[model samples]
Target: MDNTIFAQSIARIRSLETKMIDKAKIEAMVESRDFNDCLRFLQDTQYGSYITASNYEEGLKSATIDIYKEMYKICPLREVVDILALRYDSHNIKSLIKGKLAGIDTLYLTVDAGTIPVDRLNIMVKEENFRDMPKTLRYYVEKAFENYKNSQDPQDIDITIDKGIYEYMLEIAESSKMEYLLDIVKLMIDTINIKSFIRINIQERGRDFMQKVLLPKGNLDKDLFLNNITDSLESFANKIMHTDYFKWVKEGLGEYIKKGDLGSIEKYGDNYIIDYLKKAKLVSFGPDPIIAYILARENEIRAIRIILTGKRNDVSPDIIRERLRDVYV
Candidate 1:
């Protein structure tokens, strides 16, 4: 985890980052006159070949898969890549399961960035056979099915799979024995829990609902959320001031309470993680830069989708801007 094993992969990723979608490019896309104009903005970057006026979604998914393929080839430790790919795998599991139960197409929501190929995963979910899937993911897939059967709730599929995603992430971090990876995973869990907490309160759900949604073993204690079930979001934000999330939670709550902007909380959380990942630039050689590059690409893909969707729907630039996540520098 702390060696020059990742030197080659980091070098390739460093060069790629330069060609990445920058802030100026993002602004051009956002301020574009229409959806076609936004497509023009991406045409000059790495996304040029894959994107078009009508099928930006396909391009985005392709770009995501291409990066994972490149990283898998260059990265010395495949597990490092697996840690990032696991998120996509979990996403596919959730989408496919829900789609199967509802008897509809959810392929558009699936990304090819997972460790398993998209076609194979779709088939696996269709046939209800995951024996060939990754062990951690397979177990979660089975559990999700059971949870859904018991509750007859499609939301159970999402929640169970979401929990599984982080569980597998934490396991990867712990097994890798990298303090950096472990800490990032913990912060992410804390962030997810916080978002869930906010959503339940915003929806006026009960503490019993909170108990079912919260994940296990983040840096923050579960009681911090359970005990604060009755407090306002503002009060809860004030309480977490001494924790690592003090700054964003405080600032984000302002927009949330005053304007009912839930996106602010999410934007601040993404910014927080990107700011944390910025430190990896100082590490001459390690897995840090590799993971940082992966997430940076993910952030870039999300921004592209946001701007294009906003353009298509004629949404305001200011409102769209609020929905965007922080760019990796």
Candidate 2:
């Protein structure tokens, strides 16, 4: 436990959270009856608080990048930095390999997920040691190339790339010594598992084919979920009702009970997991400050983006508030 790094990371995350809270308060003030008060808040804080007016989905994506920028500033560990570098490098490779296969210009493929400089990733793509990229990313690039070569459909190739990334993420999660990181990875796996199971059972498509594509690091019994693939959605939900997650899943899925909108249910599952991780970060205080702070700031950025999106859409504040996930403090 290097208290120096731990304390610094914690302090940074708290500072970020406070800034986000102030932004939220300003946004709330804008929603109040006083248009003049909203104007005052806007003038006093500068327009940085105005992220609430951006497109919801895109804002979330930007927030992810912004939070990662902050995390990289505080995280001294080479493992985390290497992972980020590899991720961006892989994203660039995926774009290049896929774009070439599709007969499209390489510019069409963009890097959005990594902290690495775009020029650096481009250099890696041109280098012969692409296989030397992070182990997870090397696997992703090779798989994407292989999948593109074999598959005629672009969608199929893209799915192959995504599945490969998830598989690698799960492997990292299982092998890592950090319990919090493992939990975060497992939560991601669980969300993917839930979505995959529902799609398999309900649609009866791609049986035994994409089934193994799921990352299986979650606390949930992977075999149990797979075995129940033939059950109705309600039945599957009922089976897991004993767990603490059941209530959230039930409420999220209940909205589509009659309409049977699986997409919305899947979104609910993702949201819940994100919320769960935010809560998890709060309780994780120790030598793992690097892990905890990165995760917490990520969630806070997510919340800010959500609020910004809601305000932009002119959605009622209450509705937007209801949709807001927990921010780590």
Candidate 3:
């Protein structure tokens, strides 16, 4: 893909960035007295027009779909868009496959923001016909089905499909020949690996489970994790302290040691990735800004959902604030 191809799209994304929910706005939403107050706050932003008191959830979903749809329309590089959107495809696949195995209707859970339409993906999964699907996706669906047949564990479907999505994403990034995007993908893969290592270690799961779930194409060596699977979390953190993830690992380890909450690790990892992506803001004409904008918008939506849900449940504002990840803005 030509770097110049995204010049116009990046400009548009820069304009759209002004409409994104900023830190102050998110703080206000967090401090909002009730769910209605939160909805009213959203109504005052880019998302305001899409949201209604009676259907905030649907409104948020609509806004998400609209953002992706707009990106598809504005960006000349569909491959870049597809690479980001493929995660949604993998998510829909997991929902559909799990629904099928359990005899449940999960159509509502599927999002249409993927490269392929939700209905078509549902059909492909149902008929086991993936001729038109991407090779990685096709492989994942087939392998997940076979795994499910043998183990009858729904989690097998999720694990298999997730690995496939990352593998496919890395392939797309490499094929695009964009080192920036490739670095971002590798960072994400490494983050996932780190988080998984922390979780699986806490669960005391062995190497087999680690081998099954650990994805390839990450910046971290798989053997580093394999070798340290039996070590203490502090020891594991010490090993990776020489890498880019040292700060986050240190903080997350502190949180884990203090509260036994793995969420702290996941949160730190997510914030670290977002912070890394924020570097794209310095680039003037490239796909990096476009990708950064998309991620920012997604993070904004996630923060809003957390605030609204917390407000609705009468959860404390301090608690919501604590759970909130760093905003891309």
Candidate 4:
């Protein structure tokens, strides 16, 4: 890829960065008196146009779709955007596959922002057609279907497709030859593996489950996890304490031991990734800024959703704030 190709796109992204929702704006939404108050706060920001729609969920969805649409239009390299958007494709596939198994319409759960169109994906899933999807994805879809057929468990579908998605991401990152992008994907894999390991341990699942669900290509090796899958949570945390995730894992383990909240791990992991992505701010050109901006915007949207949903449900602002992930801006 030509680094020069991203110069203009980076400039556009820099201008767009000014409009991202900052910490204070997110706080304002969090402190809003009620759901309507939260909605009103959103109306003054870049999300104003979308928030005016009848349903806040639909409005958020529209905003997300619009951001990807903008990214596709402005980015010179489509692959960069595709790397980030690949998760949505995996998500759509999971939803559709589960929906197919359960005899429900999963279209509502699908997002249109992925590299593949939701309708086409839905058609492919319905007809059991893998010819059009990427080979890695197609292979996983077939495998996931076969697993689900034998086990008749929806969780198998998620595990199979998720593993496939990260495998594809690793391929893209390697092929793109961008160290920054590869690092991001590796960080994501490590975080996911850590989270899954904790959950499986807590649930008292066996090594068989771990071997099947745990993804490869992360910073930690498959053997490392396999050897430690049966270890106690504290022992497991200690094992990984030498790695970059030491601080977060330590804190999350503390929370789990004290308050019994696994969410602490997830929260810390999310913020850790965001902090890692913040390094892209130092780059004045290339796809780093654009990728970072997209991630930041997506995180911003998630924070807003959490706040809005909390306000709607009469959840305490403190709880909402605790649940809020760090913003990129």
Candidate 1 vs candidate 3, TM-score winner:
3
lDDT of 4 by residue, 247-271 (tens): 8888888877887888988988888
Ranking by TM-score: 3, 4, 1, 2
Task: Write down the RMSD of candidate 1 (Cα, Å).
Answer: 1.6
Residue 99, model 1: lDDT of: 93
Deviating ranges (above 4 Å) for candidate 2: 1-5, 22-66, 80-96, 105-116, 123-129, 170-176, 209-212, 258-260, 280-284, 287-329
Against the true structure, what is each candidate's TM-score? 0.95, 0.73, 0.97, 0.96
Residue 91 of candidate 4: its Cα lDDT?
91
Arranged by lDDT with the best first, the candidates are 4, 3, 1, 2
> Which sections of candidate 4 miss by over 4 Å?
52-54
Clashing pairs in 4: none
31: Cα error in model 3, Å = 1.2
Best by TM-score: 3
lDDT tens readout by residue for model 3, 247-295: 9989988887898778899889889978988898888777888788888
In model 4, how large is the Cα lDDT of residue 80? 84
* Top model number, lDDT: 4
Scored by lDDT, model 4 comes in at: 0.88
lDDT of each: 0.86, 0.57, 0.87, 0.88
